[model samples]
Target: MTTQELLDQIRHKRSFLCVGLDVDLRKIPGHLLEEEDPIFAFNKAIIDATHHVAVAYKPNIAFYEAYGIKGWEALRKTIDYLNKNHPDIFTIADAKRGDIGNTSAMYARAFFEDLGFDSVTVAPYMGKDSVEPFLEFEDKHTILLALTSNQGAFDFQTKDSEGRELYKRVLETSREWKNSKNLMYVAGATKAEYLTDIRKIIPDSFLLVPGVGAQGGSLEDVCKYGMTKDIGLLVNSARGIIYASNGKDFASAAREEAEKLQAGMNAIMRQNI
Candidate 1:
């Protein structure tokens, strides 16, 4: 999806919530295990219950990859279902992939063309060449990892180097790469305090923020520092929403959790206007 399309969705939905479908089969309702494909079954229910409350859906690749071939098939089917059923909802392959140029280009095609994801998260540690290949695709987004929510992120991301924080340098340098206009960043919600500095470097770029809810990051703090004129934020909640209930009513519980976040987003948008 294009930036304009994403902005329009957020405006229309009165939300910027991105639901992470990190569905684990082992934790899903035991009844769903009887379904032919349990992971997709859980995802379908959650999507059905909460589609209107979120602007995006992100499926972390590891959750499926760990289960091997069956997991991958389920991921494909789940994405295809969303594309056909709710094309307006932005879809992200939270794969966090980046490699040499040739390999990155292939990874880009796998997600954007084969899987039909609207965007893919990419790791930027390898620098511009590793990322430019993914950015080549028009309208599809490459969300580069900037300040992550993990505790270990402090080891390098915030460390001073030549008087510049590593992440600050990343935001500054990435702008010069090919098709950087299509760039969005992964700025963890836990790094709320850094959003002010991050905004100074890329004031208008969209940020895909994780680490809310279960991670204990404050939604209010993220909006305060990270929000832009375009409402440039996609705050994600994974375990907090999808794992809210392990019973047959899990989908309903997920919807309730999503609705709470959506309501908060609506109020923030209103206040910003």
Candidate 2:
């Protein structure tokens, strides 16, 4: 999906919520395990329930990769279903993938062409060449990891390198790469204060913010500090929404949770206006 298409969805839905489909077998309803493909079953239900309230869905690649071949199959099925059923909604392969240029091109094709994800999260630690390959795919996005939600991010990301914070340098440098207009960034919701600085570097770029809800990041703080005139934020909630219930009502439960977040987003947008 292009940026304008995504922005239109957010406007129509009155939301910028990105549901994370980080499915885990043990946490889903036991009844779903009886299905032929339990992970996809869970994801389909969550997507169906929350689709109206959500503008995007991000499936963390690690979750499926851990389950091996079956996981890979389920991942493919999930993306295909989204593309076929709800093409307007942005789909992200939360792969966090980056490698040497040749290998990165293969990874890009795997997600952008084969699986048909609208975007994929990539690590910038490999520098410009590793990321520019993913950016080559037109209208498809490469969301580079800048400052993450984890505690360990400070070890390298915030340190002074060449008289600027490492992440600040990253945001500054990545903008100069090939097809940089296709770039969006992964900025953790927990680091809302840093967003002021982040915005100074890339004021108009969209940010995919995780670490809300279950991670205890304040949604209000994120919007207050990070929101741009274009409402350039995709705040994600995974375990807090999908794992809201483990019974037959799980779908409805997820919907309710998503609705609550969407309502919050709506109110925030209104306040901004």
Candidate 3:
């Protein structure tokens, strides 16, 4: 989907919430295992329940990859279901992949062409060559990892290099790449304070933030510094929403959690208006 289309959905839904479909079989309700594909079954239920309030869904690739072929099949089914049933909802393959130019192009084809994801998360350690290949696909986004929420982020992302932080350099340097407008970024919600500087660097670029709820990131603080005139933020809540309940009411519980976040987003947007 185009960025404008995504922004339109956010406005219509009164939300910028990205529901993380990081499904863990062990954590899901035992009853779902009785189904043909437990992973897809759980995802379908959650998406059906929460699609109204959520503008995006991100399925972390590791979770499916761990299950091998069956996992991949489940992922395929999940994405296909979303495309057929709720194409308006943006889908993100949270596969933090980056490699040589040739290799990255294949990965891009896998997600953008074969799997049909709207975007994929990419690592920038290999520099411009690794990322530009993904950027070549028109209308498909390459979300680069910037300041992450994990504690290890301080070891490099915030450290000074010639008087500039590495994450800041990543943001500034990425803009010069070809088709950089197709780029979005991953900024951990746990480091909300850094968003002030991050916004100053790339105020218009969308950020896929994943650290709220389970990781203790404040929704208010993130928007206070990170929000743009277009509301360029996709705050994700995985465990906090999807695992809200592992009982028979799991989907309903998930919807309740999503509604809470969407309501919070609606209030924030109203303030901005």
Candidate 4:
């Protein structure tokens, strides 16, 4: 989807919630395992339950990759279901992929062309050549990992590099790449306070924030520092919402959790917009 279309979805739903479909078979309801494709079954139920409140869905690739071909097939079915049933909802492959230029091109085609994700999370460690291939796709987004929420983030992202923190340099240098407008970013909600400096660098780019709910990131602090007039944030919650229960009422429980987050987002929009 185009950025404007995403903004419209946020306005119409009064939410910028991105539900992370990071499923773990062991954590899902036991009954779902009876289905031929339990992963897709879990994801479909969650999406069906929460689609009205969520503007986007991100399927973390690692969880599926662990299951091998079965996992990949499930991921495809999940994306296909989303595309067919809720085309308006943005889809992100939480596949933090980036490599050499040619390899990156193949990775881009896999997610953007073959899998049909609206966006894919990319690691920028390889620099511009690794990222530009993803940006070349029209209407598809390349969400580069910036200041992440993990503790290990301090290892490099915040380190001084020629008078600038490395993450800031990543944000600055990326803007000059080909079709840079197709770029978005991943900023951890746990690093809410850091967003003040992050916003100053790319004040208007949409940020796919993951760390709220289960990760203990504050929605209020993230918005206070990161939000723009257009509501430029896709706050994600995975375990907190999807794993709210492992009972037969899992879907309903997931819906309730997502509604709670959506309400929080709606309230933030009311105050700011």
The candidate that wins on lDDT is 3
| Poorly placed runs, candidate 1 (over 4 Å) | none
TM-score of each: 0.98, 0.99, 0.99, 0.99
| Local distance difference test scores for all models | 0.94, 0.95, 0.96, 0.96
- Cα lDDT tens digits, model 4, 1-273, are 999999999999999999999989989999999999999999999999999999999999999999999999999999999999999999999999999999999999999999999999999899999999999999999999999989999999999846899999999999999999999999999999999999999999999999998889999999999999998899999999999999999999999999999999999999999
Higher-ranked by lDDT: 1 or 3: 3
Candidate 1: C-alpha lDDT: 0.94
- List candidate 2 stretches off by more than 4 Å: none
Cα lDDT of model 1 by residue, 1-273, tens digit: 889999999999999999999988778889999999999988999999999988999999999999999999999989999999999999999999999999999999999999999999999899999999999999999999999999989999889856998988899999999899989999998879999999999999999999999988999999999999899999999999999999878989999999999999899899995
Hey, what RMSD does candidate 2 come out at? 0.9
Clashing pairs in 4: none
Instruction: Please write out the lDDT profile of model 2 over residues 1-273, one tens digit for every residue.
Output: 799999999989999999999999989999999999999999999999999999999999999999999999999999989989999999999999999999999999999998999999999999999999999998999999999999988899997745889899899999999899999999998899999999999999999999999988989999998999899999999999999999999999999999999999999999995
